[model samples]
Target: MSNDRSKPWFAPKRYGYGAGLPITWQGWALTVGYVLIFIGVINFSEQDKPGSNFMSVVGMSVFVVATIAYILICAAKTKGGWRWRWGGKP
Candidate 1:
């Protein structure tokens, strides 16, 4: 916050742009896992099988909804600011 550029990237800033991501490394891991699940869902829905279109729609909807939820949770935790690390004060 004091214009100290030497701060670690994961450290929370006091003044500037506020916290970025609310979650910590664990949250990021979960996000990555979710992305993998999304990809798998899309791939399965693209197969040459019946109800592929319906599956695709459902999968996309789930992904979108989950993402929005995650963002909202992060925002709420960080008080509407970006955070580089998880937990603790923003």
Candidate 2:
């Protein structure tokens, strides 16, 4: 929404576009939660045999939606926003 860049929770990458590691506890929590949700979704979606090719469409859809939402939130919380960088100053 805005490029105010005030107290960002995530830092921008040094050499390329996108956010890097979390710079705040909130960011860390968000990342950890996402990972947990991802694992849960996969396990729940494939409740069949160990090597089954059956995946719940609903579970996969939820995962995809969550992933997109996470990306958008990360981009918004990243310092200097998301953009290309050549290892220069922010």
Candidate number achieving the greatest TM-score relative to the actual structure: 2
- Residues 20-90, model 1: lDDT tens digits: 44245644665576678778777866773674577777777888887787655444445444645345455
In candidate 1, position 6 carries an lDDT of 30
lDDT of each: 0.57, 0.88
Q: Which ten residues in a row are the worst by lDDT in model 2?
A: 48-57
Clashing pairs in 1: 19-82, 19-83, 20-82, 20-83, 21-83
* Model 1 regions more than 4 Å off: 1-23, 48-52, 79-90
| TM-score, per-candidate, Cα-based | 0.49, 0.83
lDDT of 1: 0.57
